[model samples]
Target: MYRLHKFLWELRRNPELAERFRSDPDQTMRDYGLNEEEIRAIKGKEFRKLYQAGANPYILLFGAVHMGVPRQEYYERMRSQS
Candidate 1:
């Protein structure tokens, strides 16, 4: 959601933050002030949930890439949920 952009912005702007997030998402998300649901969705790699929760598409894509999830996998997950 609005918060997702904040994460994305941080990731884009701060290489150290990105590295920290890549290394420890749970802690980083918590430190970054994401709510429980947002942290859950991110930890679970539930892109569809994140998307439905209002994560920007571009930011979501960035998150997916950061998580090393393939674009095809993201689409499949979205389609399965749909």
Candidate 2:
């Protein structure tokens, strides 16, 4: 969970890393040493699952944005999950 948060925060803060992530998310996540569950949640855009798993909402939102999810779509998905 700590590693997942660190990766999310880094994805939020670093443009180059964000670009790399946009290009090859699985590889980038693997490079970050994220577990399979973390990678699955992210790659599947399961923001609610991430939140339920203890990820910070702000970091998740920012990371989702960096990953090309529109704010509206993120919110809609979150709401639907609830």
Best by lDDT: 2
Best by TM-score: 2
**Candidate 2 per-residue C-alpha lDDT over 1-82 given as tens digits, one digit per residue, 9 for 90 to 100:** 8888888889878999989998998999999999998899899899998898888899899889878899999999888875
- At residue 37, candidate 2 shows an lDDT of 86
lDDT tens string, model 1, 1-82?
A: 6666788667766788888988998889888788888888777778887788777878887767766688898888867764
What are the RMSD figures for all models against the true structure?
1.9, 1.2
Instruction: Give each model's clash number.
Output: 0, 0
Stretch of 10 with least lDDT, candidate 1: 1-10
Which runs of model 2 end up more than 4 angstroms from their true locations?
none
Score candidate 2 by TM-score against the native: 0.91
Cα error, candidate 2, residue 1 (Å): 1.1
Candidate 2: RMSD over Cα atoms?
Answer: 1.2
Q: Scored by Cα lDDT, where does model 1 land?
A: 0.78
TM, every model: 0.79, 0.91
